[model samples]
Target: MGRTFIAQRGQTKSTNDRQFRRDRQTPEVRYSIENAVEIFIHAKEAEGLRKSTIKGYHDTVRYFRDWLSHDIGYIDEITSTLIRNYINYLKNDRLPYQGDEQREKTKKGLSVFTINIRLRNLKAIFRFLVDEGIINKNPTGNIPLVKDDEHEEVQGLADAEIDMILGSYDDKQFAQWRDKTLVLLLLDTGLRINEAMSLTVDNVGFQQNTLIVPSEIAKNRKHREIPISREISKRLRQLVDETEQYFGEGSRIFMNAYGDDFTADAFRKRLNRLKKKLDIPKLHPHMLRHTFARNYILNGGDVFTLQKILDHADIQTTRKYIQMDSEHLRQQHNKFSPVRRLFNRKGKRL
Candidate 1:
């Protein structure tokens, strides 16, 4: 006789019951992790995220998948515990893959700021999944960002340093004059390097003495007009005329020797060359921006206005520049102290 299969507790001798046992033995596959990542990327692209932002999301997920060794195929296999372990891995085991130099320098792992960026990207992916009803719970929900040094003094170039950089360029050479004009514009308006490079002749309002940073090129994707000084306006007009005469009427204000758009990387490399030539090791593009912010705050410009000028979405970011103007703060305190004023009025020596 054939061996008998007896039903245990909560079991029945029916065809449906037998099928249920089989189902328990082999769980259903909902979605693979790769498929989920693809879906998330498509959704983000549909939502009008920038290509760079989408690339960040894809890269973060790709790194996470690589860490899993490709064994954990299903999205359901991911858990809070696994994510915590991954965080630990980032803290202890992960090494920077930038280059041999970076790998040797950061053998301890990535910096807290970089790790936080990856964490944020991963969190965004899982949050999207939960919001779309693809996942019931977010694995990264309970995770918190690693703390960074917020009070570290902001580095802005000194007046002498700025003078040195500005004086180093020659006005006679086409490239040199263009670079000098670029530096002056950066200092005057505090525009990000990319935004400044994207400017065209029409973007400048010569009569209004303002620069119109359009929504397409603005970092925050919001349009705003920045008031430019008469000096800067003149310099910009000269650049436009020079560019037009040389390149035969191009829209872009800044162009490479080949009459192509000047890229941020090219600007960075130029700064690197200047840094070596001037022996100002800290000379870089963003330093010019920081110098602008510091000077703006010192010259009695309010943080609220600075926020708009710099296109900072948060007032808190603009407020940091206020802290950087400690010398200015001291001068204001010395000039306006009520006790000092009262003593002066009374002719008291103290």
Candidate 2:
């Protein structure tokens, strides 16, 4: 669908008539950002995003729809001022998509981190529109991302807190084994909830003690083999045997009470409830993933190796979780006393 505009001709009656006649046939409408968004959705689906990620983009687009209803539908109408207002709206107003705060009766206000994630997706949407010639330029190009401090504390379960949560689980409940195993698997392997839930019994190799994730199941649709520790292997073997007794071949290894694969939301809710019950704060799935990365890097794991293990598309993304190692910090502190080094300095005599 192309839009045409009649160019004004100064003191030219004949040219005006010709342009007006041409304009009548072609509808004078701006590019629809809404339609561009739909195209973006189709494009993302074609890229083969996991079902959960596609659902998230769908929800983000749904919110964008609400945002459009308040703003205008045309891509050309998306001025910088409008984007500023939308950013402020997300920061101040409670979003419809976020879950209700457990403490408060009202919906939880959006966090800076959460806002940036949606904004990043929004950036991708407009960038795609511009590249596809759906729009002449991206309106979001000039919009600044919400900045955040690099040293900001990540929310996750500490070692002690994880122990407490694990301690609180009932060993007798079949669900407990499933849930606990899932958490441990995430911490051990850094697998996303969807990836972990997609695992089948055949993915595990008892002899080699390795978990081979196929390309189709991975987030980036790339396969890699991850080593499994004896502890994780033992737990998985028990869980697999029990699960197989009830479920036949080709069925998912993990299942909820309803015999369905665990959705990410359901897993989160269960984890949050466990945290509340255990009086452990800020426990989540990605937290376990974070804990895995942090500990792995601190314990001398290589960055390049970590990137492959985490299945990060870029090495820079892997670097975020790699903080200064404790040993490195200690060595730096020891080297800070230059006076002691000078006094006892063993260098070649000048």
Highest lDDT against the true fold, candidate: 1
Question: Model 1, 67-175: lDDT tens per residue?
Answer: 8857788887899899988888888888777447733654766778788999999899889887776776789999898776665645777777778888999889888
In Å, residue 227's CA in model 1 sits off its true spot by 0.5
Q: For each of the candidates, give the backbone clash count.
A: 0, 0
Best by TM-score: 1
lDDT of each: 0.83, 0.76
Residue-level lDDT of model 2, residues 243-327, one tens digit each, is: 7777755668788766677678888989888878877757778888877887776566888998999999999888776554455
Model 2 ranges with Cα > 4 A deviation: 1-33, 46-54, 69-71, 95-109, 150-156, 298-300, 323-350
Cα RMSD (angstroms) for every candidate in the order listed: 6.9, 6.9
TM-score of each: 0.84, 0.75
lDDT of 1: 0.83
